[model samples]
Target: MAWDLSVDLIKATVQLEQPVGDGSRTVGTGFLISDPTPGGKPRTILVTAAHVFEKMPAMSAKIGYRVQGKDGVWRFDPTTLKIRDGDHPLWVKHPTRDVAAMEVEAPPEFVKAAIPINYLAQDDTFNRYNLGPGDEMMALGFPRGLSANPAGFPILRAGRVASYPLAPATSFPTFLMDFSVFPGNSGGPVFMAEGARRRPGSNQTQEVQFVAGLLTQQVELSGERLEIGIVTHAKFIRETLALLDKLPGATVTQAKAGKTVKGDPPMPPATPAVAISATAMAASR
Candidate 1:
């Protein structure tokens, strides 16, 4: 089933890890979204989480990017890619969107190897495929630092959406799901369904175009009993890309010259009539 899809699709999946302040590493999964600013040049824009990028105890972590390679392909030396400027988001000085874009110098051979990302907000047809409770999902990542066996890709663990609209009612665009999310699965793509049986030569079943959500946080349980996972809705990813377009030096256009207008962090406009009022309804005693 993995062989059927082109590299462009799989290249969007990523493994994200960074060094924390205490000399430990914090890992998760994330994927790339190809929302080029007017021009079509490549940009290293990715969607993960605000908490994921923000360092624990208020210090940010060093960001790292990983790509898929052949079973025998040795991992590229870290020096092969250079992150422009300081690695911390605060240094970049853009509003904390919980997402960040980087300018990296990738090796020549790795230039054209990434998959283009997609979004549900592109059309009504795409949004209709958004996931809800009881739907199937597959968390693809290197959980527990376990590398692939003989396969070139990481392991894919199957799961389901534990809840609907992962964010609070006030935050309509965001959603969450319950999966067995682990240490390394953050920023990974949580696919709708995997390997649905198909006949040898058919239309290929639409290629599951609805990549409805992204794996973000895993609810840590106290004991051996399994609990749930959390996913950020794909819509936030779309919004992040739109915001990136507004930033300076994003594309060929000259950045507007002046101090950036700063205020509260930017967020998507609230959904209509979705407010939660504590006093509108009478208490049932």
Candidate 2:
């Protein structure tokens, strides 16, 4: 498989964590996406699920980043990406959606590492793909906060679109991916990358890729869990960004570094979502 999709996915995704009452922490995932319509300040927002942050007990959480050392080595650096200090929510949730975004200043190199807004599939663009049930898709995330290597890179998982009429996803705020999601996979990029495909009448194949959407939940029956992942359509993400555009700074209240925070409802999951917060689950374990 080509590495472009995996590369971009891992480069942009990070782990979000905060301490718990027992001196431990819960873990979730988040990724970097540029505001689709930037007006003045070239905004870069951290994208994740509202439920992920809502389960937190502290206003502030640390984001995990991989920084390259002068020795040409990558190191896992836990950076303090503050949200709110007290009762204020650090992220702006979509009015009726499970998604949320927040503005923040990150390392210049990291900002540059963000996935471009255009990478997301749009109305006409998504229509072109002609996706349906069983088409292959992939996601980059940390399952149970575990990465492939020591540098803290995300793990790549592949699945198919389990929802029909995959196009015009706006009508359907969410879709489904046929992948088993773990506790820490929420807020990760659920996308299809550009790749080669056979043309109908020709011996030649064409390359294509798309940011299908963001993974939100995993599908599970009350008694038996299925390996299905629910993904929020990227359209709502665009809508949320547009909503933020209306705000002066497109920001939620700044989460103070020292303040302790305490923090959902699930998306009426057609498919299951990865809702087990590492912190929340770990405490119970």
Candidate 3:
């Protein structure tokens, strides 16, 4: 297994934490992305599941990013990412998807390791690879709010792509995998890396990596865990960002420092027509 490939993938992964007044925290996973502009500065978007924000709602939630300290060791640093600084909605939720993207002017520390937009799987890449069941895949995320190291690197879990009709991605836009996902795994990146291939019309070889989708939730049945994970396809992610790009750009409105922001929670978007809950749907053996 090319586990080393995770070095690049985890760099873009961010830990979403909402600290409560009772010294507890709500945790989830998110990643950073840079979408290129024709002639302007590329916009930095924070990608995560919409349900993440709704869990223990807060106005100004903090995102955890790792950086090396003077001791030459990585340490976690919390940055206040304002979701709603006063009356402004800092986050953009996909109209009907379980996705949300925010146009954030993150500091160099956070943006330096973001995943490039081109890593997203395009239609051609899917067709060329003939992606379907049995294809190897990896999920980089913080399951149960647990990271790999003090640097806050995500835990890399391997599984196989288990779905159909991946080529023409259906309008509902989702897939499934066999990883036993925990509650906190939502919004993590699902990817395949450096698959060796012959160059076009030549015998030369090259390596290609692509992000496929995200771990949204787990399917449970009657107090039992199914070990099947629901993956929200990458197409919806691209769609969410595209929807954001069409709007006018605006400067970030920061709230006063040290003040814990608060706001009413937003409603969770509707689930896909095919309910994959353990009770609603069974795992394909």
lDDT top scorer: 2
| Model 1: per-residue Cα lDDT over 184-241, one tens digit each | 6555665554355332366444335455555555554444324465655555556556
Model with the higher TM-score, candidate 1 or 3: 3
lDDT of 3 at 45: 79
lDDT of 3: 0.68
- Answer with 1 or 3, whichever has the higher lDDT: 3
Off by over 4 Å in 3: 1-5, 37-39, 197-206, 253-285
Candidate lDDT values, in order: 0.43, 0.70, 0.68
Candidate 1 worst ten-residue window by lDDT: 276-285
Q: Against the hidden reference, what TM-scores do the models get? A: 0.61, 0.83, 0.81
Residue-level lDDT tens digits of model 2 in 1-285:
455765876888887776666544566788888664454567678888777888776766777667787998976666666677578776788998778888766677667888888887787655565567888889977776677676777788999888776667657777777788877788888887756776546777766676777777776665454777888888878777677777765553432322333331111112223334731111100
lDDT by residue for model 3 over 130-210, one digit each (tens)?
567877789877666667775567788988777776666554377778777875678888888855756666777666578
Which scores better on lDDT, 1 or 2? 2
TM-score, prediction 3: 0.81
Candidate 3's clash total is 0
Q: Identify the superior model by TM-score, candidate 2 or candidate 3.
A: 2
Better of 2 and 3 by lDDT: 2
